[model samples]
Target: QVKYLNNIVEQDHRRVRQRTRSMLGFKTFMSAAKTIAGIEMMAMIKKGQLNIPGSTPFEQFYALAG
Candidate 1:
């Protein structure tokens, strides 16, 4: 049962692996971390996972921004 769980994590890591491969290298780990964070955040937003209760993600973002 636990053996199958790693596949889920590996699948998630595939996106980051592909991106890093395409970019070759970053100047610093911070830059790479920020890029990965942004990519994951965008994925979550696109999947409607980042939206606030009773609000769209864009609306939640705007509310937090102001």
Candidate 2:
């Protein structure tokens, strides 16, 4: 049976898959996991979920980094 409920997951994974396709080699699972984590983190930041108080998204990253 075809499950339509997982469409949301497939949609979310599309970007991640595209990102991985661009990259060359991942030596191991740990490295791949780290890459995915970084991709998701950027996605959250872009969505403003990780924005710091009183700062725009771009500024928030700078604040966190510096």
Candidate 3:
């Protein structure tokens, strides 16, 4: 279990570095970190067809789907 955990961390570290490597180093590290966090989040969201919350106006959505 410890070895498996290390592997997960290793992969995540490589991916995060790769992502930030393309970005311009910001004036402040905290600013850069927040921007990277937001970009990563948005990238995850863009990866697939996201399910919108079911709380939408269902009649309109149903009509649109039809």
Candidate 4:
């Protein structure tokens, strides 16, 4: 669990910076960190570790949450 958590945290931060480079530069580091974590969840779905149902691109993972 620590590995997953740490990976998410690091990747999230990286993605947030990538976003900033494109547009919407964050004014605060803390705020960007939180937002990054949220977006990271979606990005990590590419790993397909949860085995979500259906054949959707990423929406199937959302289905498994229910």
Clashes (N, CA, C under 3 Å) per candidate: 0, 0, 0, 0
Per-residue lDDT of candidate 1, residues 19-47 (tens digit): 77878689998988888876776567767
Per-residue lDDT for 2 in model 3?
80
lDDT ranking, high to low = 2, 1, 4, 3
Per-residue lDDT of candidate 3, residues 1-66 (tens digit): 485898876664565678779877789988887766655544434443333555344443344345
lDDT of 4: 0.63
Please write out the lDDT profile of model 2 over residues 1-66, one tens digit for every residue.
567869977876777888999889799999899788777766778867786778777776656545
Summarize candidate 4's per-residue lDDT along 1-66 as a digit string, tens digits: 475898867765686567667766778998877666656665557656445566664575456443
Report lDDT (CA) for all predictions.
Answer: 0.75, 0.77, 0.58, 0.63
Highest lDDT: give the candidate number.
2
TM for every model, in the order presented, reads 0.68, 0.65, 0.45, 0.40
The positional error of residue 44 in candidate 1, measured at the CA in angstroms, is: 1.0
Ranking of all predicted structures according to TM-score, beginning with the best and ending with the worst: 1, 2, 3, 4
- Between candidates 3 and 4, the one scoring higher on lDDT is 4
Query: Which candidate wins on TM-score?
Result: 1
